[model samples]
Target: MAYESSVPYRAGTEGYTSFRIPAVVRARSGHLLAFAEGRVSSAADSGTIDLVLKRSADAGRTWGPLQVVARNGTGTAGNPAPVVLDSGRVLLLQVRNAADATEDRIRRGHVPPADGRRIWLQHSDDDGASWSPPREITGQAKLPHWRWYATGPGHALQLRHGPYAGRLLVPANHSTPPTDPQDSGAEPRYNGGHALLSDDDGATWRIGYTDSDSDTDTGRSVAPNETTAAELPDGSVYLNARNEAAAAWQRVDAVSTDGGEHLVRPFRPQAGLSGPAVQGSALHLGDRGALLFSGPAHPSARALMTLRTSRDGGLTWRTAHTVGGLPAAYSDLVRLDRDTVGLLYETGDFSAYSTITFRRIPVEEPT
Candidate 1:
């Protein structure tokens, strides 16, 4: 059977010219919330982008209008990482930047601290109805000397097993200088992956131990940026990352047992899973005895929005079905119920930047 998708957001609609970087979460009360960055003018990726959202109460069969959740005026505000707590509260963690600012300048120490891609958070007590003002959490969520950083860009996780039950975990990536400098720009040489947690159900957050190796690996996509995570039945975090872009367009996976505080090993490339240096998503549909991953299954291109399954807790993976054969990139997955999941991803005809889309896939056993 062919997988069907809905174009809830178009490239030029709702006053925004482009929509990108999708993230979705199924709230505790059964409301479905889909999020993306609404680029105001051109799709340059770093200017006048606001975090926007759409709500669906009918399990994605229908959706409401768009609502600007986090807007920093003309500045850039994006990377929607949302997670729903057991008590029905929705916590969103995002990144902020200055208007027209770029990542190169920030990494070279050419940007000011005020708009240097820091962390901010917003929450809603009544499902997706309302959101609080964007509160800066840079001090708590970020560490000293870190330059480029990003959260899940997908649904964060809440531990349901082990001693850290109810712990809210956000899989994230960051970068700093290597042990030795080779450039005059003082550029960041290594990328690191870690998890941020909130013990009080999203009230406050703290950075974890910063993965393995204080001075870890690096790549174009980097070793750990734009990664997704799932909690294994043993209470360990199974992390899947976009390993390297320009060179090896493949994916990597690792495990962390300390409630996402650290990884057991550096993320090693998985042989079967293929990508085009794009972000993907992972959902541990543990009850159904399946581990699901979403991304462009094409070996060297960002087309074919495909979903793969790993029945043996991510030790292996196989393509089950594909969403489409269009230009697709950067996706996030949400668990709708025991037998279904949702995908919010960037896809279009001209390019992947046309608009962020949503797809509903019925959970099935691994092929």
Candidate 2:
């Protein structure tokens, strides 16, 4: 099915500058809000990276003005995952890079302060119109002593029709060590990749999966990139990850049936089209178990920023269609109704951070 693309979303100067790493969700009130890392100015202070937002009132038919949600210089106001809590409030779990402003640690692998790039949450009482002050997920405020840096890719979801009904599960990306031996420590090699779960919405978190003890044993840290998740029919939570070992292109899977309590093994590679640079969102579309992914559809080279659909979970995929003609990075998708799908991606030259593009994608049944 060839879905026609519409130019409903675009980046603005203030909050939409060179937008990259996008996350979108249809709020409880049928409102669609797309969030991205907004680059405001070109100056050093401009280097301050923040999470900007755009709202779509008419089912993604169009978008509203841009607004800033979170910011930290060159340090990235990374990806955000929105989950309408059991209490009807919308809570966003996001990553913030505090040390991104320092010129000294640009490329030298300056170990991010303990809490270098940390996870925080912003709650909205009025359907994203106004948000409360950002609060760090974990209250341990010693900063550098926090030890963990860069934790996110959080997709908070509630268990539907399951034993754990109301409990909120936040599958977030984190840099940590593994617990089980059978599990692969592929993350440590690449410095990170793991998921953390929070029972009390975004208040407290527990490690779902991580690397093994020995560094040499763990080949690559499978950083779960801009990944979205879904609960399988059997009550297992399947997390789609962009393993750094696979160059962030290949999609990895983590399964936890008892909610997000503990993940079994690390992950295995699927045979579809992930390459050197791929970041995506995986959605369980319909009855055929259709899994739709939005990411850099770089089959060989990072060229096509596209959307691909698979009849089976992640086994096989049909030829994808590009959302925007240019380079598309860190794309996200939401199910408007069963048939309609809304997509948001960072468009423009990812190499130089030129511009961010957002759009409305209408999915249709293949003829």
For each candidate, give its TM-score against the true structure. Answer: 0.94, 0.79
**After superposing candidate 1, which stretches have Cα over 4 Å from the reference?**
186-189, 212-222
Superposed by TM-score, candidate 1 places the C-alpha of residue 317 at a distance from the truth, in angstroms, of 0.5
Tens digits of per-residue lDDT for model 2 on 271-335? 57564455567766555466677777665555567778876556577755566556655666777
Give me candidate 1's TM-score against the actual structure: 0.94
Which stretches of candidate 2 lie above 4 Å from their native place? 1-12, 15-17, 42-46, 72-76, 99-115, 139-148, 151-155, 176-189, 211-215, 218-226, 246-249, 286-288, 320-325, 349-355, 364-367
Best by lDDT: 1
- Model 2, CA-based lDDT: 0.59
Candidate topping TM-score: 1
